[model samples]
Target: MERSVEMVVALLGIVHAGAAWLPLDPELPAARLAFLIEDADAKVTLTQAQWLSRLPVGHQAWTLDALPQASAFEPISVQANDLAYVLYTSGSTGQPKGVMNEHGALMNRLHWMQDA
Candidate 1:
């Protein structure tokens, strides 16, 4: 994973073959990453082995260099209706409701733009 957030690693594992979880730092606390690691129940983690010694005492860690190369894989065949992304904007309620879109809906919107 690119970031130390465990969800990113877990999601990557689900989405990719030969996936390995790795943590990076932006001067962020290791504790935050550690929580993510534990929550994800990741058996092995990738980091500099040197930094592994510096990690909090119970978590398992490994060097990124030791990880195997990612498998050669085809990209996902996502339809336009598939989720593009969600934008969160604050409103009256504390929680945000997702606005879903389908490929046809987006295409129709684009067609209008072109005609304009």
Candidate 2:
């Protein structure tokens, strides 16, 4: 029952106003995480203590366990058009894709029962 770090981070980011980057191991050190943070222009990085200390300055870092406490600061109001997720596939070479969905999409799917 191990949850994906990416999914957990995305959820936490939406809830707590932060970004999550999964670390790379065995292949390369911090390569994927670094690229994603840079590409996304993430201000805060939610990661392990070792990864946090190694990253460039100006990044607010926190561990997974600390996310709940951090998310309590402010409530984010998600609008109908707000982004729901950016789910990435687990492929070799790690090509990440964003799966953007909204409240409208969810409602439309839920209301399909009427037509069926």
Candidate 3:
């Protein structure tokens, strides 16, 4: 929920699971969060128990505290064109807009940033 090691781990888990990470800050209004969750079609949100009540209707959550034991981690085929993540704008003009970043483009930028 809050900035914690578990949050970071969950992020990496999402990346490994070949899913785009759409972080919904707890501080954001519930309405905004609901909109994002719905827009992203978020089937399962990784969150802590404290934030469960904050999630609106049509939302499902997976609490990190009750994580099941894992036996193995298998890799998935992730293409360069695959979506890396989605971030929403501030919605100064209207409702926030989702900006999608593909793996290839994100990696290209990261490589460039390292070289810069």
Q: What is the lDDT of residue 13 in candidate 3?
A: 86
Tens-place lDDT per residue, model 3, 63-86, is 998876777878899999999888
Question: Estimated TM-score per prediction?
Answer: 0.35, 0.46, 0.86
- Tens-place lDDT per residue, model 1, 1-116, is 33556545554553343333333342446665554455445576556555665455776665555756668766665465554323233334753343444445656787999999
lDDT of 2: 0.51
**What lDDT tens digits, residue by residue, belong to model 2 across residues 1-116?**
02466546555555444223333332333555555556555566555544555565565666655654533355556566755434444546566543456655655776997778
Task: Return the top candidate by TM-score.
Answer: 3
What is candidate 3's CA lDDT for residue 93?
A: 100
Residue runs of model 1 more than 4 Å from their true location after superposition: 1-17, 20-26, 65-116
Question: Which pairs clash inside model 1?
Answer: 81-103
Query: Ranking by TM-score, best first?
Result: 3, 2, 1
Q: On a 0 to 1 TM-score scale, where does candidate 1 land against the true structure?
A: 0.35
Per-residue lDDT, model 2, residue 17, is: 45
RMSD of each: 9.3, 6.3, 1.9
* Candidates' C-alpha lDDT: 0.51, 0.51, 0.86
Native-referenced Cα lDDT, model 1: 0.51
